[model samples]
Target: MKKKLLASLITAMMSPVIYAQPLPPVEVIGTPDEINQQRLSKETVQSNVSATSDVVEILTESPSVSVNQAGSISGFPVIRGLADVRLDVQLNGMPLLSSCPNHMNTPLSYVSPSQVDSIEVYPSITPVSVGGDSIGGSILVKSDKPFFAPTAEQVTQGEIGAYYRSNGNAKGGNVEVTTANDKISLTYKGNMAQSENMDAASDFKTFTTTTNASSGTYFTSGTEGTTTDKDEIAGTAYESINHSLGIAYKGDDSLFQATFSKQSAPYEQYPNQRMDMTDNDSNKLNLSFDKSMNWGKFNIQAYAEQVDHEMAFMDYKTSKQMPMDTESETKGLKASALIPLSASSELTVGTEIQLFKLDDYWVASPAPLPHMMQPNTFWNINNGTRDRYALFAEWEKELNPQWKTRLGARYEMVNMDADDVHGYNLDYFPTSGSGGAGNQTTDAVAFNNAKHAKTDHNLNLTALANYKDSDTFDIEMGLARQVRSPDLYERYTWSTWPMAAIMNNVVGDGNGYVGDINLNPETAYTVSANFDWHAANQKDWGLQVMPYFTHIEDYIDAVVERDFNDDFKVLRYANQSARIYGVDIAANRKLAENNYGDWSMKAKVNYARGTNLETDDNLYNVMPLNATITLMQAINRWSNAVELILVKEKDEVSEVRNEVKTPAYSLVNVRTSYSWNKLRIDLGVDNLFNHAYDLPTGGAYTGEGNTMSINGIPLMAVPGAGRSVYLGFNMKF
Candidate 1:
């Protein structure tokens, strides 16, 4: 499909050199903004493509939500007012389950922009088929179906394309090949690169020549400076590795996809207590299928993934080794169906089941034996897992031309089990820790004694109403009740590592611990409404605007509290109330008539603000108001484009003190492409202007009061990359 799109983009670039005309405003397809509105395709509620991309560069740059990417490792997407599972993510109709204790992966880690067909972000609840777990609403993501790549017709057979982007020594490439016939077709696409990121500006009193001022922990950027150890706050530059490959198959009745990826990076992150997450390796395998027939359109998918991570950062004023090594895996399946009864009605139903697992194979060699439970010795190992299943359905009907109503319900079940399989309990080993080594004590390869399990049930009900095509505006409203259970981390594991604490890597505290056994699933009451306006449309010009809101009950998240030991700390999962709301507005204009190689301009601005409602605290990682403008030029076999992007500052923060303060900024980027026969080439400069910035603080445990390393190095402000560029090429036979 990317091949087809590239081809079409090429044809649009070539074919008669007529200047490109601006396109009409596009309606969102999946967002559940107002009551009874049917938003699909050109109308998918307000889709948020950012859900499947990296936080630093994904789509949600609203004014209300603030998002900060922690180095290249993990990303936190601050929604209108929620984070974690409170904001559900549905990928290709299936949930992209996030099962990490630290939320290393959110919905954003899955696919890139090229693989997306639409993004549906219901900043507010609007339907039941989309689920009811959202206190911060939801995002429904769809990938391009395996269809022949599209290209303007000169009459066609196939097409090919390539592109390059770079800044400094930084560079990358993208290539796509596609072909299709009336019955069978396929699209193959991939991107690969090696580049250096720019150092991040510091969080001190000065950042750049034109920096900002800080009062307490609050930072307002306007007049910026580059001072303090501010420069030290920058993430490593030139640390690199990124690549991905995908294939889509299309038949008269179905679509199938297979994909794989590998990525790596070395850098320090911000708002974190530890120094780094390095020697990191990640592997992913995914497969999915979709089919439509007389009965209905159905979809199902299965995927497995692993992250081989290593990090030797400063903690407790000491250096805990890297790859203290931890690995995580997820395997699961999901299926859904949509059946049409009449032109005015449809019924949608689906079920999904998946198993999530985690294992921490400590890299400490000499592996532990039965009698070696001495204080600092390598003792045991552990493996943990969680399983989940959900069934849901919804029915919709048009009561009249201007009014639509719908009803839906869902049921979910969960089961979890975890234990420390191999570890000795010599004189000092806790049952939860890896066991001992040598003499008189017991020794084992995989101990299976310490274990635990739990089962859960949840149900949700929904109602929706939409009033469409009324004057020049539209409205949609919806309400839903949803329940969710605690995952693996929320239930098992409670071992301390000499590796926790910023100044105590050599000291001691349980680094990766688990919460108590008695915990309740989170439940929410989500109500949402949307108001949309097509304020204007003239020859080659159009405008669109939308806004919405949502509320949640018993929100689930980990909180900090003193532990049994007077000098220690541990995290526990608890239920809290939360409410979130936000809005999106966009517009487009034809730069010229479709004649003379059509040329045009496009731009969008979005914003969202979320609150815990209970404490009225900001959810971690929410995005802030943002806007983008791009100039597109369409010509004969040749075309190019340029863009300007802007993101504002974020102030709302979680209750945790010393919380990182984020600053706002802007950027510039450009791209161009050319086509000859079935071959094409292109180039792009992301962060074209190369602005330096830091994401929201990603928390790393710091013992009571310390931030220095074993080498006496004060923790640096971990920020993402600065400027980057890429160069890529490709062709079809």
Candidate 2:
């Protein structure tokens, strides 16, 4: 299978060269010429910014990057099949941590697409300068920088944009205002978005009622029986608002900036998880200074963030509402300097210190509640702290005019600990024991008695060489050794009770998970090679084929700790070995230019496979083979495009977790935009054929029914949106 896929990728890359024509160059954001990274083109970002509010969704435009569907705006960006905390995702130089156990408020969720000025992705063999405490990849999201007038006089400029989509009646808008002179600048940005539950093209479930014989049924909305419409996909509605303010000072050879941002999400329903986000509020402050010294460049940054998150079942799920709350505070400082060793070489050295504190506790149910949750607050994780200190250095040298090399090393010390924890109503289920109910007390006691603190010293190294064979061809190869310590929830979630274990699921797999403090940090050894073929001018056509492999030691996987009637087993996090390999093909060409417009085409294909060496089980949530092709037309002030997306059936399922398999599918979309002197209008249609399909990585559906019961509801894949027509307009002044 791997050989066949490789052959197909080679064929795709060569096809574009046959009909290539002169075109403009593709822009690389924030990346040097020697860096091996995938960048989103400005045109692509502008075209899709109005279609979706999800910031991570824009990552799909790059090769080997996918999204794990969750809430409307909180999709997890999957890089080379690795999702969530496994990847290093930074927003405006700050690494934000998700506070919720379910990862309901991901790092990227805080930023709207309207605020993005650039996105850069460094896959598999990432450089240590940009990667640390991550085994997979790195994503950098940067907003527009402070702008100043050419002269001393002050200048004011900004943008206002709004968009509406037919599906789920999604509507949103954004506003940006800035005032600047040659010496100082001030800016503000705000965004608001809301949507109703989206519908699928066809019914994907057999039963309308959310009930079964195993779990007792209950009345919903004052009715004896509740039914969901066949075409309606419940628990997909969402609403959110964000605001940010910035001020900057520019002086000769130096700059200083400060930014503050806040986010409020009243509700964000998730179809793949048992609980939805009832409320999430986050605030952040960032300060930075940049100076040009005699040696090179120097920069220092400090950032702080706080998150207050609450989760409960939405109206769609007629289950007992158990409120889960999480509060986290994060602070970090980073300093870096670049020095020129010689005319052909430069070195970068940096250090970072980060401290994270979290409190994940559940408010006890008051009187009249039947569950065992009453009487005492449940301390899932009290006074949890994860601190990391890191130092890194990278050296880049121009070996010759046609060859460049880079080497980097990073060392990180991670310390993690949490206070003792306990379940609710300890008196009801005494430590003496009762059977299923008594397990909670026993588990709590064991966890409380066990060691609660852990520290790990990790090291990472990366080496790369880029050989420019000619103006039209070049190849970049690299080797990397990366390391990542477990996150707070991955090592501290102690409860074995199904209810509590299930709430800690970050993958939305509808299964319970118990953490193990003994699990070792994951270390990955990776090798990657990229072959590039482009027009001599670097503008007519381009094709890049990259293949990579990674072997992970002490990979954090799960083993069945307990099973309830052989359904939805409670799994414990364990250290295991794993392997992952993949190939990515990307190409672009200028077909022709005529009175109709300048015709061009761009395409990307990604394939990945992962396996657990210990159990020989397929790794969970690995995305299936997928590809995207887009044809674009550009003339004067109007831009238009037609896109096609394809995905293969996901048959390599994870037997341990009973991961759902989705069928093969394809989709078509069309977009058109026109720009005038100060105004631009965009119109687009997604899923034009209204095809019915499930997201390959959407995970199992547990949105409704008796979600508290491990197996009360049938498992199914979350369906994709059917169709939507969107219109957007932006005015600049």
Q: Give TM-scores for every candidate, taking all chains together and pairing residue i with residue i.
A: 0.70, 0.93
For model 2, the stretches where C-alpha displacement exceeds 4 angstroms are 1-32, 209-227, 316-320, 427-438, 565-567
Report the number of the highest-TM-score candidate.
2
Root-mean-square deviation of Cα positions for candidate 1 versus the true structure, in angstroms: 9.4
Over the stretch 1-733, how does candidate 2's per-residue lDDT look in tens digits?
Answer: 9999989755643343332233333432213384678777655676677899898888888887899999989999988878899999999999878998889899999999988887888887668777588988888899888999888588999999999999989999999999998999999999999998788988887766543332443211111234576777777889999999999999899999999999999999888888888899999999999999998999999999999999875552434446789999999999999999999999999999999999999988654445677767788888999999999999999999988999999999999999877778663323354333536677877777788899999999999989989988888888999999999999999888887788889998999999998879999999988888888776668888989999999999999988776558789999999999999888888888665567888888999999999999999999889899989876656667899999999999898998989999999999988777778899999999999999889988877777777787788889999899999998999
Can you write out model 1's per-residue Cα lDDT over 276-325, one digit (the tens) per residue?
A: 44445566767888899889898877877676654433221122222345
What lDDT score belongs to each candidate, Candidate 1 first?
Answer: 0.50, 0.84
CA shift of 725, model 2, Å: 0.8
Ten-residue region with minimum lDDT total, candidate 2? 217-226
